[model samples]
Target: MTKKHVHSVTVSTLSDPLPSVAAKTKKTHSVWREYVKSRYLFVMLLPVIIWYAIFAYGPIYGIQLAFKEFHILDGINGSPWVGMENFKYLFFQSPDFWLVMKNTVLLSLYHIVFGFPAPIILAILFNEIRYDLFKRIAQALTYLPHFLSWVVLSGIMFIILSPTTGVVNYVMAAFGLEPIYFLGDQNYFRFTLVISAIWKEIGWGTIIYLAALVSIDTQLYEAAIMDGANRWKQTLHITLPCLLPTIAIMFIFRVGGILDAGFDQVLNLYTPGVFSVGDIIDTFVYRMGISQMQFSLTTAMGLFKNVIAFALVLLTNYLVKRSGQEGLI
Candidate 1:
C-alpha cells in the first residue's frame, strides 16, 4: 500500500471505535451525574448506614470471643483460642444449660401456640366490626401496650399481680379466693410471661394481618356471600387462604426467634424463685456473661442461639416453599 493509503487506513481504524468508545464514556458520565443529582438522598441515608455500621455490624468482631478463651487481661486479640471448649461447657458442663434451654424452647412454644394466634383473632374481629369509631378506639387501646418498654410493663405487671393490694388480688378476695403471687410462683410465672407477651405484642402483630386483610379482594367476600356462605365459611375459605402467605412468612420469623423467648420481659419479671421455669437462654447468658463474668461461655451460648435461629429460618422457609406458598428465604 502507498504511505498515504496506509495513513488513511490508520485514521479509519482509530475513528471507527470512537462512536462506541464515546458512547460508553458518556454512559459512565451520566451514571455519576445522576448520582451527584441524588447525592442529598444518599446523604439522608448516611445516618442509617452509619448506625448499622456502628451498632449492627461493629459487634461482629466479638463473635471470635465465642471460640477464644476470652480474658479481661489478655483482651479479645490476645485471648487464647479454645476451639469448642466453650460450646462443650455450654452443652455438658454448665449446670443451668438444660434448664435454661428447656425454658427457652417451652416459652417459645407457648407463645407460638397462643400468642401467635391471638393477634390473628384480634385482627379478624377488628375487620368484622362495622362501627369505625369503635374499631379505632379498640385498636388504639390494644396498640397502647406495645409502645411500653418491657421494663415499664413489667413494673406495671408487678403492681397488678401483687398479692397485697393488686387489682387482680382484690377481685380474687371479693370472690372469696386467696390472693396469688403470680410473678413469684413458678407454676404461674411461665403462664404469666406468655400472657403478658401476647398482650404486649398482639397489637403490633395485628397491624401486619390488618394490612394483609386490606390487600384481600373485596369481590372474594362478595362471591362467598353470593354462594350462601356464612361469615365463618368465608373466613375459612377466602380470608384465611388469602392470608396464608403472610401468615407463613410471619410463622417462619417466629420460629427463627424461638431461642430468644423475650429476654427483656423474662429478665424484668423473673426472680430467683421463678428461675427454674422462667430463666431462658438469653437471661442465662446475661447472668453468666454480665453478672458472673463468664465471657467466652456466654458468647458461645449466644453463638449457638444464632446458629439455631438461622437454621430454623432456613428450614421453615424450605418447608413453606414445599407447601406451595411464598417464603421469606
Candidate 2:
C-alpha cells in the first residue's frame, strides 16, 4: 500500500509541467486560428497595409542613421556606426538647437492655449445664433481660408503686413503709430503663425464639434427648458457636457500633432530674419536633408519629433482615461 502511495505521488509530479506546456501551446494555436479567421478582413486592408509598409514601416529601418555617419552609396546597412555622435553634436555644439527647441515648444504651447479652444467656442457660438443666413455666411467666410493654399495666404499676409506701404502698416501710419514689422520681427512671427493657423482652420475644426452637437438629444434641451432652465443654464449643463468627449478627442489629436506647426506656412512666410524663431524641426529637416545633403542628421531630428509625438499621444491617452473619457488606447 505504501509503495502504491509513493507511485501516485510520483505520477502527480511528472504531470505538473505538462499542464503548463499544453496550456501555452493551446493559447498559441487559438491565437493563430483567430488571426487566420480574420484573414478576409485583412485581405480587404491589404492595399492600405501595403502602402503603409512601403511608406511608413519601410522607412523606419533608416533611423539608425542617427547613430552612424550616413552616406548615400553606403545606404543604412553599410554605413559605419558612429554611436550618438550626431545627437551629441545637436545637443552640445549646434548653435540653433536650443533656440529652435524653445521657439517650437513655446509656439506649440501658444497654439494649444488659443488655437485649441477657438473652434469649439466658435461652434458653440454659431450653434447659439438663431439666424440662418448670418450663420451660413459666417461659416463660408471662415471655411474659405482653409481652402486657400498657404502660398496665396502668405502672399496676402506679406502684402498686408509689409513694413513698407502694406495696408495694415498704412493704417498704423494713418493712426500715427510706428509700423510694426509683423513678419520680419522674430518676437512676433511665431505668434503670427499661430493666429494665421487658427484663421485658416477654425471653421473646419468646428465642423466636428458641430456634428457632435447636432447629435445631442433635443429632448434634453426641451426637458431642461420645461424644468425652468434658461438658455445659458441649459448650455452650461447639457450642451457643454455633451460636447466634452468631442473636445477631449480634439484635444488629444492636437496634442499628438504638437510638433507639426504647418510646414507650408513656415516655408512661405519665413525669411532669414525670422529663421531664429521659425526654423522648426520640419523646416530644419528640409533645409538640412534636401538642401544641405545632411540626410542622416535631418533624419535624426525627424525621428526625435516622431518619438516625442508618439509619447505625447500616449500621455494624452492616459490623461483621457484618468478623466473617464473614451481614450485612443
Candidate 3:
C-alpha cells in the first residue's frame, strides 16, 4: 500500500505545469486579483467607458463609407465598392477641393501661430496679478464669452461690427478712418475669424495653465528672488522651465486637432462673399455631407483630414522630444 501511494504521488507531481507556464499563470492570477480589488473603481468608470463606446468608437464602423458608393436604400454594408475613386476626385478631379484644402490649411496655421500662445500669456499675467478681487473679476469677464454659443456671439458681433452704425465703425469714423467690412470683405474675414476664436477660447484655455501653475514649487520663486532675479527673469527661467512639460503636451494636442479650425465660429461668421478665404474643411464637409448629401465624398475628405492631423501630431511629438522637452507620448 505504501509503494502504491508513493507511485501515485510521483505521477501527480509529473502532471504539474512546467516552471515557465506556472510563472505565467501566477502573474495572470496576480493581475486578476488586483483587478478584483479595484472592481469598485472600474464600476465608477463604467459610465465614461459606455459614453465613449456609444458616441465615439461606435461611429468608427461607418468609416468604411469613405470607400463605398453609399446608397441609403442599399445600406453601408450593401453599398457598392468604389475603391479609391472618392479620394481620386478629392485630390485631382474636383475643382473646389484644392481651394478648400488650401483655405483649411492656411486657417489652421493662422490659429496655431496666433491663438496658441494667447492663453499661456494670459495665464502668466493672471498669476502676476496682486489684487485677488480684481483678478477674479477679470477672469469672470473673459470667461463669460466662452459660455455663450457662437450663434449668440455672432449676432452680438454683427451689431458691434456693422459698417453703417456699429460701434467699431463709429470708432473708426471718430478716428477719421473709413469703415471696413470685416465680415463681408474676403480680405478681413480670415483675420476676424482668428481674432474672434482667440477671444472666445483664450480664457477657457488658461484654466489648464493656471492649474499647472498651482503645482509649481514656491521655493523656486523664492530662490530666484534671493538671487536678485526680477519678475521677467524668474518667469523666463523658473516659471517657463517648470511649465515646459505641460506646454509640450498641450502643444501636441493642439497640433493633433489642427484640422479643426473652429467650425462653429466659421459657420456662423462667414458668408458667400468670404467663402473663398474663410471656408475650411469642416464647413466644406458640412455642406457636402448634410446639404448636398454627398456622404461618400465628404467621408473621404474627413478621413483625409484626420489622417493628416494624426501624422502632424506624431511629427510634432517627435520634434518636441528631440528638442529635449517632454512629449505627449
In the order shown, the candidates' Cα RMSDs to the true structure are 3.8, 5.7, 4.3
91 in model 2: Cα distance from truth in Å?
A: 1.8
Structural similarity to truth (TM-score) of each candidate = 0.91, 0.83, 0.89
Clashes of 2: 0
lDDT accuracy of residue 214 in candidate 2: 96
- Residue 268 shift from truth in candidate 2, angstroms: 1.2
Candidate with best lDDT:
1
What is the overall TM-score of model 3 with all chains considered together?
0.89
Residue by residue across 1-329, what tens digits does model 3's lDDT show?
69999999998788666776889999999999999999999999999999999999998998999999999999999999999999999999988898888888898889989999999999999999999999999999889899999999999998899999899999999999999989999989888888999999999999999999989999999999999999999999988888889999999998889889889998999999988998888999999999999999999999999899899999999999999998878
The CA lDDT at 52 in model 2 is 97
lDDT of each: 0.93, 0.89, 0.93
Cα lDDT tens digits, model 2, 1-329, are 69999999999999999999999999999999998999999899999989999999998888888888988898888989988788888889888777777777877888899999899989999999889999999999989999999989999999899989799889999999999889999788988899999999999998999999999999999999899999889889999999999888878988998888778988999999998888877788788888899977887788788999999999998999899999887
Off by over 4 Å in 2: 1-50
Which pairs clash in model 1? none
Worst lDDT 10-window in candidate 2 = 97-106
